[model samples]
Target chain A: MPQLALNRLRERGSTERAALDALLDDVLAGTLSTVVDGKPWVVPMLFARQGDRILLHGSTGAGALRHVAAGAPAALAVIAVDALVVGHTTFDSSANYRSAVVHGTLTPLPDRERAEALDALSERILPGRNAEVRPMTRQEQAKTLVMAMPIVDGEFLVKTRSGTASPPDEHTDAWHGVVELRTVALDPAPAPTSTAEEVPRSVLDFAGARVLA
Target chain B: MPQLALNRLRERGSTERAALDALLDDVLAGTLSTVVDGKPWVVPMLFARQGDRILLHGSTGAGALRHVAAGAPAALAVIAVDALVVGHTTFDSSANYRSAVVHGTLTPLPDRERAEALDALSERILPGRNAEVRPMTRQEQAKTLVMAMPIVDGEFLVKTRSGTASPPDEHTDAWHGVVELRTVALDPAPAPTSTAEEVPRSVLDFAGARVLA
Candidate 1:
């Protein structure tokens, strides 16, 4: 991306957009933050990415949505959860973290582009999801609105950092900090009674694990 | 809670402030989002709770921090990766989710209040960690800046919409959309050959899981 093209993510100063794109792909929704008259407001919302354009939506009367629709400048973002880092250098130095820091403006998408944005948002969370849901009703569709922003090249920066909290180099304590990680699997997918020992590969393929240490 | 207090979270014109508070108590630091110009930025960070004050911090010149200090509205959020719900619903209808949203003005701690904010931020990540490292070096303390926001009751809302995605009413499918979650851990502490099974409870408790998932 060119210099003017990378306007939003200038502080990150990176050459790779793919790294941040992958992180955004795995996460479904994002939390939006903006200042209105000096007071701050945050909202959690769903989103989608089409090439470099990020699509997000809200109900007709959603205050934040309406506020931005009225032309207020707004900020939108997404994040992935990683583990908590508790370091060994200092018993008290433990930090938990993951990837973050990509930004873009929230602009009202045109009606002609609405369907694509919605589809993108749905697919971002669950593949093939649009095919499954009843199509958006005309009235429902009318009540909702979508916005898109390009997250291309220099427009965004993706930062992913990990490691336990470490004591300053000067401190040499006997104990170390810890990063606690916990992983949980779906209740073992029970085999169908008629299947005997045959287990569905889907069950084997999709297991749950939540690790945060 | 009163409607005015809930600010924008009033769907039924009521507040779920209690649940929201509990979520905050256990919310990890990795869930914060910010904005720059028109784009949204997401970042995983360190956090702490001191009474009603929620603390967060980073390199003073970090892109996210710089943006916030410049008077851009910021939000500190805590999302709990909750449960997996399975319905007789198809993969299309199956759904799973977590909960959290915190909106607040992000301001640098005045030079005089820096120590308190940093203390709270460090302790929040690991319960007994505040005093383990060398006391914040004058330079380290100067280099790091903290932001504090009150846990307002009304502006808070805890949303829980999760389960196996199913048809509107009841249409059982042959294969339900069973969700499997995956988390990757960062670096792990080296295990010592000299020691046998004698390990601290914290290390032993989460040993089977990733060291920094």
Candidate 2:
């Protein structure tokens, strides 16, 4: 439960737990940072949040995930980019984003919990997907490694940059503000043999209520 | 110049140097992971490729960058999320993405090269922005810390997953294909006091060629 100190850009760092959860739940992907053997690695992995713990799954044979399960230190970073803040001056320009960094050791999930965790991940990424897809067989489950890292009390950082630029330079009379961007799901492309008339409801639901700029 | 070994998901790992360069050049943002004082940190930063080195700049007072400058080992991961591959089964669903992971130490850029690096970054993120915006003043340059990590011969990995799932489950009759996703710049919102009638050509150019879906 120790707090992770923000040693730089303290003004932009937020300790709000809601902000952390919101950022984690919204982003679908993140890079997992950990050391393997003697080399450092940043591995990209899909992640979903379950209560106070973050769920991450990968091939059971992945060495990086195995090391984390064995109690190696790790950090998972999820970033939701909002827009590019174009400032009147190059020095003042910055990207508008909501980023969360969580640090903890991952533990392997039990069989029963792992099943639910897999469904939870599907639901998070593609809502209503658990019902549309076939259940995972035992052999498939065995080959998958499901792990969770507690959203430790203070070992995280949430930083966000939104709204207009911090007042443009006085000498420059150029325009400045955020050019908003949103990630909306595009129409699904059905496989060659599939007969579905369109993307299923689950896919539609994922793009629901997008914050339009 | 030795190749970094692929220790996990060997099937998804790619060793082609061109693939690494292409992924790095296309993605605008990446997380820089480094260890400082025995604690791991994954800090998000904007990056651009210049020949054999990756250019990254931040505030001079930032601790994470300072550690990298002091020769702490670092990995910069750039990922371009291409799509979400929805499968007939929950277990088969996965995302389509191109990711590049580079491992190396960072060295601070000297004065002259630092200026060029800043312009290179601007051009990469916002093409033609260097000419569109006012020049960075000397004092502004002094407070900004620019650094580069050499793109070693084989100390990098590029992995990409595109197209439909690896043949869906035979028993399930669900649709399958990638739900493409792209990051396109939105209309620029000029500040309330600004006089520009429309977004600059550079901003428009960035989004012009997007494959609208």
Candidate 3:
């Protein structure tokens, strides 16, 4: 498949398919944008990448999801800001981030695949979660809407910025460097209605993986 | 201005203006979406909230920026996931997040206010850096494009989900709770080109404010 060309800031664009997949695997949520009656509409959504297609689940009554179901073209952008770069001047200051945008028309998952798709999304949020909980009831599955968008090569773009600030043109006493940013998962708090006294393995693993060492 | 009605999930919608401002102030970046020749295009952008408007700066040569500058309506979405809420079943699992979507036509800041606007953007990223660094040169200013969108009542929507997962109708021994998430700023790494050996107060302050206590 043809690769989507990066028209601006060509230096930051990456052509490797591995880079695109890596970015998608790292970020959990993104904003889905589409046009509604000639005006742009966008909303934040939680998604998981399943092979070459991204899966999104929501209530069937959701307005944005319903609009996309009606055949509107959509775009999903996932961006993770890694650090804040400080330079000698404000113009040179910027953030280090990994961003990916995928464009496609979403298709509602067939009834036979809806359960598996929901499990894919659940696994992304909390690995090993399906085995720990009960299966989704038929009524629950009916209320949920699952959609997938193909991650075609020509319809996607990935850009990343990393490392320190640009080397200063003229060295001065001003401080210049980068402050790394990371998203950490803190301790779990049990819900009042839960009968479970012990934290599950999935929760423990997620926190262990996400906490700053 | 009239408030834009929430067409779905009204319980998650926030009517308070303060909530909108707070979400914008907390998130340093968001996805900006607009229609380019009837196709949806979106890009992650670094932005800062300045009173009732959000300030965005980019190169004049950026294609997405140029499209918005040509009078297309744009929508900016800022979302921060606060926690992963675990439920008894996959259907009940969800994320806790604070999200705000602002819709408006972005207007490029006039030359007279461009400097001040840039300062505002800078201050948001690094509160005290503007005072420590030299002013932007005219040449640097000429290449940058700064734009602002008004946060009017009818054009914006704020939604948030927080606290624990929903109470289970049937008590189960399975674990249920939330794994809180936070964006943390780590230690600063100085660039090789810097002549200064000591980190500045601004960097220290930013790290102090963002690090998990």
For residues B48-128, what per-residue lDDT tens digits would candidate 3 score against the true structure?
889888888777778778779767999998778788888877777877887888999899888888888888888987899
Expressed as tens digits, the lDDT of each residue in A73-155 for candidate 2 is: 88998776677777777677777777778999989898888788878877777778888867778877777778899997789
lDDT tens readout by residue for model 1, B17-69 = 66665656655443565555454455555465667766766666566567776
TM-scores (chain A) of the candidates: 0.67, 0.89, 0.92
Name the runs in model 3 displaced over 4 angstroms.
A1-8, A211-213, B1-8, B211-213
Which number leads on TM-score?
Answer: 3
TM-score of 1: 0.68
Docking class of 1: acceptable
Query: Fraction of native contacts in model 1?
Result: 0.11
Cα-based lDDT for every prediction:
0.50, 0.73, 0.80
Interface RMSD of the candidates, in order: 9.6, 6.7, 6.5
lDDT order, best first, reads 3, 2, 1
For candidate 2, give the lDDT: 0.73
Better model by TM-score: candidate 1 vs candidate 3 = 3
